[model samples]
Target: MNSSVPYLLAILGEGVVPPSTMVCHGDDLGLLRGDGVFDATRIVTTEDGTSRIDHLEEHLSRFARSIAGIDGPTPDMDSWHRLIEDAARNWRVPGEATLKLVYTNGREVVPGPPRGFLIIAPLSETHMEEREGINVLCLSRGVTSDAFADAPWLLGGVKTLSYAVNVAALRYAKSQGADDVIFTSTEGYLLEGPTSGLVVKANDALWTTPTGTTGILSSITVNTVFEAADDNGVKTATRLMRRDEVLRAQGAWLLSSIRGVVPILSIDGHPAPHDDEMTHRLRVWAGFEE
Candidate 1:
C-alpha cells in the first residue's frame, strides 16, 4: 500500500490503528458466513483542515436498525461515535472520502460479543466518473416485489456484508458493457441498483421504489435528496414501477451516499430520456455541487 494514500481504521472499543496491521480471526462470522451489517457516508475536509461527516446521525441510525434486523445486540452509539471521530481525525486527507461503519456477529463457534469497526478511505476516480453518468443493465433479482413482507430471513433493507449477489450483478453488468445494474423483481417491478436507490422522473414528479415490501434498503442519499427537492418545490413520490415505465420516464438516476446522484444515460442498451436541468438540480440538492 502507498503511504501517500491516507487511511484509518478503528475497532469498536479500540482506538485508531494502522489499517494494514489490524487482524480478525479466521472464524469470525462476518467473514465466514458474511453475517454483518454496514453503513457508509461521505466525509469531506475543507482547505482549512475542517472535516465534516455527511449525514452521520442518519447513517448511525440505519446501522443500528440493520444490527437489530440481524438480531445482534444494540451497539454503544457513544463508543462508535468516538471511534468514528478518532478515525476521521487520523485520516487527515483534505478531500472527498468514505467513512464506513461495520458490525458483525463474532466468531462462528466461539462465545463472544459482536465486532464493530470503522474505515476511512479516499474516494476513487470511478465514483466521480459514475456520478457524471452511467449506462445500466436491468437484471432480475429473483424475488417478488413483496418478498420481504413477512420474510424476516430475507434480511431485506439491512445493509448486510453478504454482498456476493450484488457484486456478481455488477460484474455481470460490466461483462455486458454496462457500468452498473438496476435490480428488478422477478415480477418485473423496478427495485433498486446494486448499491443505490432507483429514482425516476415522470410527469414532472420524482418517483422511487417504496422500501417496506420491495426489500429496498432505505437510502440516506435518496432521503436527503428528496428533502432538498421538497425544499426546492420539487414533487416526490414513492411507489413500485415497471421497467418500461422507467425506460420511458423523463429521466432516471441511481442515488447513493458515496456516489451522490448518478444519471442513467441508457438502460438495457436503450437510450433513456435525459433532463440536464433536473440532473443539475439533483446534483446541487445532493451536495455533489459546491
Candidate 2:
C-alpha cells in the first residue's frame, strides 16, 4: 500500500485506542448497541480543473434524517461538516475518487451520549471498476416489505452501523455464488439489495420500489437516473414491484453512491438479457459515459 494515502478511523468513546494520527477515540454510543446512522458519498474530479461533490447535500440530508429519532448521544453536525470538508481537501488524486463519511450515536454506552463520531476514508480510482456490473441472487428467508412494515425493528431504511443482518444477507448470497441479494417482501414485491438500489427497465419505463412501501433507502443514483431518463425518452415510475415482473423485465441495474450504476446479468441463477441502449443511457446520466 502506498504511504501517501491518508486513512483515518476515529472512535468516539472513553478507554478506546490512543488519540493518534490514524485512530482517534471518543465516548459515543454507536459502539455499544449500534444506535447511530451514516451516509457515504463520492467525490468526482474532472480534467477541466474542477472538483464536484456528486451528491453531497442529498447524502447529508439523508444522514440527518436517519438520526432524527434518536434523543441522546446525537452527532454534532458542525463537527461532522468540518470533517467532510477536511476530507475533501485531503484529496490528492487528479481524476475521479470517493469520500466516505460515517456518524454514529455518540455515547460511552447505550444510555450515554452517542459514542461514534465521524471517520472519512479516501478511495482511489483503482478501487472502483470502470465497466463492470453486478450479479445478484435473491434470498427467500430474509425480511420482506410486509415484515418490515409490521415489525419495524429491522430499521430497513436507516444507514445504521448495526449492519450485521445486511452483511449476513450478502454472505448468504455469496454462499449461493452471487455478488449480492435483492430482498423481497412476503407479498412478492421487490424491496432492495443489501447495499445498492434496485432498478429495472420495462415497456420503456424505469421503475423501482416506492420508498414508502419497500422501506429501502432513497437511492441517490436512482433519483438522478430518473431525472435524466426523460431527456433520453425513457418513462419513469415507482410502484410495488412484483418478483415475477422483475424476472421478466428487459434489463435491470443496481444503483449506489459509490458504484454509480451497474447492470445485472443474472438473478437467482437465471440470466437477464443485457440491453446496451439502456445501460449506455444510464451510464451517460451517471457521468460514466458521454
Candidate 3:
C-alpha cells in the first residue's frame, strides 16, 4: 500500500496495527457479499490526552440488536467492551477519530464462528467543515413509506454492511455540487440522510422520522439531542413529515455521531432557515462542542 494514504489504526486480537493488516479472508461473507452489521461512534481526544467515546453504550445496544436481526449468536458483550477500551487506550495522537465495530457471519464455505474487529481513525476535514453547515439534495429512495412495515427479513432498522446504494446517492448529490443527501420516500415523505439522521424544528418542537417499520436506522445522536432538548424544556417528537414541510421548517439539521449536529443551509439551491446560535447550542447538546 502507498505510504501517503494515511491508513487508520485497527485492532483485532490484541494491540493496534495499521489498517493494511488483513482482518478478513477472501471467503469471508462480509467481504464477498457484504453480509454483516457494523456501528461507529466518534472518539474525542483533547490536547491533554483525555479521551471519551460518545454514547458508547447506546451504540453497542444497537449493535446487539442488529446481530439478533440476522439470527446470530448472542454477542460476547464483555469481549466487545474490553476491545473498545483497548483501542481507546492505545489511540494516541488523536483529535477526533471514529471507533467502528464490525461483526459478520463466518466464512461462506469454511466453518467458524462470527468474525469482527474495531478500527480507529481521524475524522476527515470535510466532515469537520460540514459541521459548520451543509447544502443537501433531496432524492427519491424509490420505496414507499410502508416498505418495511411487515418485512422483518428486509432488515428494517438494521445497520447492515450493505451501503452501496447510499454511497451512490451521496456521490450523485456531490456531483451536483451538493454536500449531502436526504432520501425521500416514493410518496414524498421524508426519510433520512445516507449516513445521518434528520431533525427538523417545526411548530416549536424538535421532530425526527420514525425508525422501525419505516426502515430508518435509529440514530443515537438524534436521540441524545432530543433528550437534551426535553431537559431544556423544548418539546420533542417523531413523525413523518412531507418533504416540502421539512424544507419549510423553522430549522433543520442532519445529526450523527461523528459530525454531531449540522445545519441545512439550502435544499436544492433554495436556501433554508439557519441560525448560528441554535447550531452552536445543538452541537453542545450532541457533545460535538465544549
TM-score leader? 1
lDDT of 3 by residue, 70-143 (tens): 87888988888888887787776558888899988879988877887988778888998998799999999998
lDDT tens digits, residue span 1-290, model 2: 35666444444432123224453135455655677677777776555534567778788777777776344344566666665665555444556555555555545633544444444445545236523766787765345565556545666567787777788998887787788788777666678877778889888789887775356788888888888987767899988776678778888888877777888888877887578888888888976678
Candidate 1 vs candidate 2, lDDT winner: 1
**Candidate 3 TM-score versus the reference:** 0.95
Whole-model lDDT, candidate 3? Answer: 0.87
Q: Which ten residues in a row have the lowest lDDT in candidate 2?
A: 10-19
lDDT of each: 0.90, 0.68, 0.87
Over 4 Å off, model 2: 1-27, 45-51, 72-78, 108-112, 115-131, 148-156
In model 3, which runs have C-alpha deviations exceeding 4 angstroms? Answer: 1-8, 11-15
Q: Model 1 compared with the native: what TM-score?
A: 0.97
lDDT of 1 by residue, 1-290 (tens): 67877788888887887778654788888989989999999999987667899989999999999999999998999998889887877777788999989999988887888899888888988887888899999999999999999888999899999999999999999998999999989989889998999889999999989998888999988898899888989899998998788888899999999999899999999998889898888888888885
Models 1 onward score TM values of 0.97, 0.82, 0.95
